[model samples]
Target: MKKLSSKIWSLIILFLVITVVFMSLFTNFLYDQLYVKDSEESMIEVGERLQSNYQGGKVTDEFVEKVEDFNMYSTFNVFAVRNPKELSACVPFEIDYDTLIGPEERRQLLKGEPITKIGYEERFEREVISVIVPLTDQNRLEGIIYLYYPLARITELANNEVIILISSVVVFSMLLAFFVHKGLGHIMRPLNELQHAVEKMSDGDYKTRVNVSSKDEIGKLSEAFNEMAAAIQSEDEDKKTFLATVSHELRTPISYVKGYSEAIQNNFIEGKEKDDAIQLIHREANRMERLTNELLQLAHSNRDQEKIDVYPMVISETIRESVDLLKNQSKHKEVEINLELDDSLIVQANEEKLKQIFINVIENSIRYSNKKSLIYILLKASGGNAVIEINDQGIGIPKDDLPYITEPFYRVNKARSRADGGSGLGLSIVKDLVKQHNGKLLIDSELGKGTYVTITIPLMEEL
Candidate 1:
């Protein structure tokens, strides 16, 4: 089954409702106009028949009998009045004379003015169309005749007209709806194709393109979608090429460092000069090891479903261990690393990875701090998480370099970084490890003041 879009469905429903309502109103208006004219003409004929009876001087008992009999079969009420006082004298019908006609209406009839009124009457509980005419003999007003016709027949005729009009309208409306729907489908065929093409493109089938020949908005949209798919395909190819080149370039140095370090360690050289060379080789090996580890971590982090092992570990203990490992490196500077933590504070994390996280952050602090400057470590639970902050007063990173500080191999000052024996992968590893624990790593630094690295991890369930 095909599903219609909300926009199209709404338009269809709106169009159908409007067409129905408009046709109903138009049909009612046309029928009312036709029935009004017809009823008025019928009323005139009834008035003429009453006038002819009066002019023949048929104003006797037999004539009154005929009028009384006429009221039983016909829908008109006939009355013959000589004057306002003798209104009941000439009329034989048992009529409610006063209730039916007012004094002003009688006066107008006597003065040779014919009266025609069409209105609703409360007494009859229905509408009446009355025609009153003067009966004259020898240029004198003999009497006035009233012809009252009930509007029931006109109402019936109007009802029939409405029924017929509605039936015709329904039939026509159905036909119109069918044709309109078909026309709309024809117009939207290209849009439907364009939509299918876009779906294919979204599913990575960039070769799909819409063949919209019309010079309209939909056509322009088709052209733009094709162009976008082409551009995305080109970008995807370029990214693959760049990643391949970067992988090849990074692996070559790592291979050399590993090979030479292994050769030196295996006694491939000897003597004091060889010892120095071996030490340099070992340093290069460690540097390469750091680089390779960062690359692997980066690849793992980029995966959508990388497995992470989380557990409880003491925050203060991790910091103390990391500082002790780098204590010899900071001996010449007399750098003092201090911890401000609660003894029982713990965090949920991967234990080994969290240790590496602490090592990278603390080592970066030692490398950048001024000689003899103190590195402060603070650990506490704040806002439902265990927060560890490392603050160092050093030549802080530049403002622009701060954003890229955690990118692998990115250095704020390359010369200074190399002097500190950093491969520029420390902070990047810190960031990845923090993320693996479902934590946040924040860096705040001033140009000359110092830099602060804050790592926050969710507190363990045991508290």
Candidate 2:
């Protein structure tokens, strides 16, 4: 349940903590390697040089005097003691006799091995580095020379550098945290707005949108969100319009059939009048049936296009068949359909759906054409498609209405009425079928110049 910001900040803090610890350990290692090791080597050299000056004789006051003179010019505190117990006199405080030179150390000293000690020395009251070189004569310990330097003095330079390093790390961590917090806020701002807009849409506010201010990923996300919102709003409006249009289209026919049936039931008229009323009822019933069937076809066309099975088919033959089926309807108005076809043209499409597309467009051309006018049907291969262009010398659509002619229940002129114009769902059904077959449908027209519908279906690849 934690917020994204909290998780990101946690990771940043963890990284900084690890970096600070690594830097501290690295500085300590450098101090030991460069300063402490060199200081220990220097002390050992001084101690051995003094031990060599002993001359291999019994302990004497002259030898002790020579060591005392060497101490004045050296950085280390140097001391010479006759017995091991006398080594405590080098410092101002008392140290344990056994801790300084135990029985094990005495044995090693007699054997001529020097002992090096480095650690905290309570008597000196500081950490110290020291070396002990033995003076021997005739295989017996005569005396010893002691040398020591305070560990703090030897590592002073590295200690200063470590303090500065720790101080800089602390300051840099604080600054980085401040900037990263602000940067995260800047990055998350657009995402937050997008989330809020999505919430509004889920709550039925399809008009909600977010601002796009950059060309980055977040900005692209905002643009996509806006497009989705616009599409949803358009669909909602279309649904409302469709329902209202359906109600209006059915009301008049229902009223006519109802009024006439009631009069007939009461025997208000007989003979020819009753027969005429019955015929009118039959005609209205047919209109209602046709409207219902077209609506069902339109609904079916909106389904997933992947469900439509398609294959290579002769598109020119389907176009010719559609023309033959509609010949009687065109003949009623004395309209002639002239065909110019490329019989070899083939396309990848569903046969039934492709036939329906041609029927709708050609019928519309026939319905709007003047008496005795000629309708042109041309089929040829263009680019990689089988192109079919149906042109008519009919009353064409206005420029303003051309764009929306394919919308369900849209008519260029409402005054022409449903009875004369047929159902306004024809072109919409045509558009949907064309899309299902992965085809393009383009309509170009001017008022009184007739409409030109161009349909292009992809040709079979092998052909």
Candidate 3:
């Protein structure tokens, strides 16, 4: 909501105005002083001529003629003073000399000291500027020369200079404002795009992106924005696929249950056929129940992160138990599970979750694995940890799909997975269950070369 551009522009203008105004004032003051000094120096030259040419430091007719000539040729009101208080040799005085020159100035000149001063005279109703030069012969005061230069001339010139300076300041300020506005706009353009992108994302448009090329902060922000959008887009896609997979899985089982139940009720089949149909109906119901149970497990995991009842348990026994439990299923698939276990392999884990982890992994191997394939189940204590490695000669997952093989509802071969009665949550559940026991789960697979899954857990003592 706060305008950063306006704030920056205001500071820039404030600096410019302060600098320009100070320069203008100081320049005008300097110009006025130098102008007055030049005028005084010119009068000083004329005053010296008059004093040197005078006899006994007094102005003669020739001197008077020269003064008239100097006045005519030069720009000054020239006069000669006999004493401090009176004008002796002269021009027709428009302003009384006694009233025009101050007593302090008159005394200093009459005592043979030359003084130049600038003042305003309300008595003469005009501003006055004058240079007074003392006439001295052998250091004795004889007469003084007064040179009057019009102060109006300096004011007029200063006014003209000020007008020009103000005009230039105005022009420069205009240019500065224009460029600053443009520069700020360019800098903020990326940020504006980012804002729009965020708004689009908020509105559930995950495809939003900001196009930026510069390698500055704004560009980095744009890149981050795009990355976020991509992540959200990917999750959204995964969710849709999951929904479709789940819908198909649920619908198939329900269709069988509904069809078989209706058939049994309507006597559509004879005795043996009816029994087979009921068995199929039970099988479909069990499949649906298993799917729902896995879903509930996922939901329970999300809801109860700290619900695990962890304890020190022997992993070898747990593995043996899980293998025994799946013995019939493995026999049906003609899969040979080879067990290599270390009895000392004990770990801190939730017993139920550990059993579940092993069950899911072994079931997956049995389902995907080719008939009569060897499934290696190995457990050992190594480097202060209990390690479980399961390598299965299943129709192995694709090399590219190894990374996402543990994601919920992610199947390497969708059709094959579905045919195997896989809701695609088996590996995902196993992964979560192992993690709940503070274990690391690693999977490596190659197409047609089987898959290896390793679980590493810190070994707990017999306490």
For lDDT, the strongest prediction is 2
Better candidate number, 1 or 2, judged by lDDT = 2
Off by over 4 Å in 1: 1-280, 304-306, 415-421, 461-463
Q: What's the TM-score of each model vs. the native?
A: 0.48, 0.82, 0.66
Sort by TM-score, best first: 2, 3, 1
| lDDT tens digits by residue: candidate 3, 309-354 | 8888888999999999999999999999999999977788888888
For model 1, the run of ten residues with the poorest summed lDDT:
87-96
Better TM-score candidate (2, 3): 2
Q: lDDT per prediction?
A: 0.72, 0.86, 0.80
How displaced is residue 274 in candidate 3, in Å? 3.3
lDDT, candidate 1, 1-463, per-residue tens: 4556446657888987898799778866765576555666665676667666664443565554565566676666766555534655543333455755577866665566677767676656666666667776655666566666556643465577788987998899788878877877877888889788878877978778777677788788878877887888777775676476457545655676676667677888678757776676667667667667776866676563348876677877877877788989678677888789876877777777788888888777777888889888898888879888889987788899999888766779865665466766678777877887889999989988789999998887752
Clash count, one per candidate: 0, 0, 0
Model 2 quality (TM-score): 0.82
> Model 3's lDDT to the true fold?
0.80
TM-score of 3: 0.66
Q: Please write out the lDDT profile of model 2 over residues 108-217, one tens digit for every residue.
A: 89899988887786766677877889999888888888777777743455477788996897799788878988999998898888889999999999989899989998
Check candidate 3 and list the clashing pairs.
none
